[model samples]
Target: MKKLLKRIKALIRKIFQQFSSTLEPSPPPSYHSPETWIPPIPPVPSFAPQWENGLVLVCSQCTVEQFAGSSHRINRSITATEELQNWLKSRLKFDGLWGKYRVISTSCLGICPQSRVVVVLRNHLVGQQCLLVDPQSDREILYSYIKQMNQ
Candidate 1:
């Protein structure tokens, strides 16, 4: 019994020694002070945005809500999202205009009310007009809304 206890104590001491060695802190680099350090700032280029204008953020996971404060099951949001993208592409007809505007699906837009949600922004600048659309309900209406923004 004494032999077993002694062996266990020795093992515990060795384990603790290994752990303490790992816990020892290392000193920081020899930088001394930040007052002497100078940061590099690149010069601004004379250029504008590669794309023409605006952004379109579509919620790919729009769902229909039966009641308030309940988790929603995803409906035809993917189809509606694809429909909107195709419609926008066909209507725009500008080469690479579709690429300029984002046509991607999102998890949820937080407004689940028996319809798909699509958000459109004319410009990313401050105070731009952002439109929230329901593509499940008359996509033509949504198209017209975007068309107005294009003009």
Candidate 2:
């Protein structure tokens, strides 16, 4: 037992020595001399709600999205269209955007159909084109469609 323990200790020492031999020497700690250390000035950040390529608009007036704004005739599904709109807005990083895109809500879109639809204004090869969204679209479908539109 003593001989076995001795062999194990030797083996461990050999392994550690091999590891240490392969390792390079670390550099000395930096003192950060005053002339060498120049602090960077924070940049002035500019933000805009509208993307350079596309615009996403949710239909707040869609009867399926909200019961208060909608009538009994708009009860088409259990899930509201507002969830899809919020998801789209989050994916587009348009949260708290009250500048440009906020004004184009569904109530202002003028599409008063019962279907829960969204509007996508995309900059295609021929300038800006409007897209009519499908009511049956879920979060994944809406995300994919928005991604495609942006591309």
Candidate 3:
């Protein structure tokens, strides 16, 4: 009886060893770093922007609360910003100020108005001016201001 129990225990131990070895996880794969990781030059050209003096940055992340009867809950800033950009582009080309200024839609510029979009005008002569503009009613005013600043 003792020899039989010992043989059974040894058989169970052998089976457990085989099962555990099959279930054991494999070793992790090795990694090698590339030798030519850094490039010799920048990927793109480094030419300066065509804008001569004025740079207008319009915030594209702002939002205004909608009126009580509107279906949408809020108004997005990009719609207003793009509208203003198109308006300015057409007018600037007509006035021959297209090369003198550039309008870019940018992320939040740190000055966040609850009901308006923030616009930053960087000019060589007048310096920097930050304006809170309502796109629906302030496009002409903003354009006039930009013209004033460039002058």
lDDT of 1 by residue, 39-104 (tens): 557998776544345556665555323322346644443465667766666665664356445444
In model 3, residue pairs whose N, Cα or C atoms come closer than 3 Å (at least 3 residues apart or on different chains), thus clashing, are: none
Candidate 2: tens digits of C-alpha lDDT, residues 1-151:
9999999999999999999988966543477765576566899988754555555666666644445564455545544556566555665565333232332455646655555565655444435444555545555665565555444
Question: Is candidate 1 or 3 superior in TM-score?
Answer: 3
For residues 1-151, what per-residue lDDT tens digits would candidate 3 score against the true structure? 9999999999999999999999986544334235434434658867776886798888876642223235856554446667777787788899999988998888877777766778899887788999999877898899899899766
Question: Each prediction's TM-score against the native?
Answer: 0.54, 0.41, 0.58
Cα lDDT for residue 104, candidate 3 = 82
Model 3, residue 51: displacement in angstroms? 1.4
lDDT of 1: 0.58
Q: Of the candidates shown, which would achieve the greatest lDDT relative to the real structure?
A: 3
What lDDT does candidate 2 reach at residue 73?
58
Ten-residue stretch with the least lDDT total in model 3: 30-39
Candidate 2's clash total is 0
In candidate 3, stretches whose alpha carbon ends up further than 4 angstroms from where it belongs are 1-49, 64-78
Error of 2 at 12 (Å): 99
* Model 2 per-residue lDDT at 42: 94
Give lDDT: candidate 1, residue 147.
51
> How much does candidate 2 score in TM-score?
0.41
Model 1: which ten-residue window has the lowest total lDDT?
A: 61-70
